[model samples]
Target: MSLPKELHSSKFEQYMESIKIMYLIDDRFKMICDQYCISKIKAERNKQKSEKYLYQQLENENLSQELEEEILFYIIKNM
Candidate 1:
């Protein structure tokens, strides 16, 4: 998703990185489990916890007001 126009370049990049990392980790776990028939409940739980922390950390940063609102909505919806 595109970030708000008001976000600083660095902050926008950081936010993208944060989201990307969560996506990477989550996708990797899902792929591994699906392909290998591995137990995934524990890994899924751990990933959820980590993603929540990442979301909170991103929210705590100097995000643009619009991006902050969007992020909050995403976090709440996911939870």
Candidate 2:
């Protein structure tokens, strides 16, 4: 199965096979991936706005990083 675009990363390339398995068999992993994608989009959109853009973009980026860390932890634990 094709991975979510947000999951396409050189950092994750080594774990690609495990990630694909987790994405298919793990609901929480899938949800996190979905949320990561949304957060990424929000961060991008924040670049086009003003005033609250910095705060919103930072928030989204932090969340994305946390989610990525979680994904990595999960993959490592299961591997």
Candidate 3:
């Protein structure tokens, strides 16, 4: 199967294969992956914003970390 576009250059790069497998077989995992991607994109955009948007960047970072942890947990559990 082709690599998921969302997994490219992500923090979970090392877990690409596992993620691809889970993403296909597990709908919840897919949603988490999509959310993670969206969070990363928002964080990147927030970086270009003014200081007023600092909180948004921080929120996105936190969400990203939480999602990463959840993904890792799922992978480990399934493995």
Q: How far is each candidate from the true structure, as Cα RMSD in Å?
A: 21.2, 23.0, 22.9
TM-score of each: 0.30, 0.55, 0.50
Candidate 1's residue-wise lDDT over 27-59, tens digit each?
674354344333444567789999999998888
Evaluate all candidate structures by whole-model CA lDDT and list the values in order. 0.60, 0.88, 0.81
Residue-level lDDT tens digits of model 3 in 15-46 = 87788799889989888878887897788777
lDDT of 2 by residue, 1-79 (tens): 6788878888889998998999999999989988988998898787667647777999999999999999999999999
Steric overlap count per candidate: 0, 0, 0
* Candidate 1 backbone overlaps, count: 0
lDDT of 2: 0.88
Q: List the residue pairs that clash in candidate 1.
A: none
CA shift of 52, model 1, Å: 0.5
Model 2 Cα displacement at 70 (Å)? Answer: 58
Q: What is the lDDT of residue 29 in candidate 2?
A: 94
True-vs-predicted CA distance for residue 67, candidate 1, Å:
16
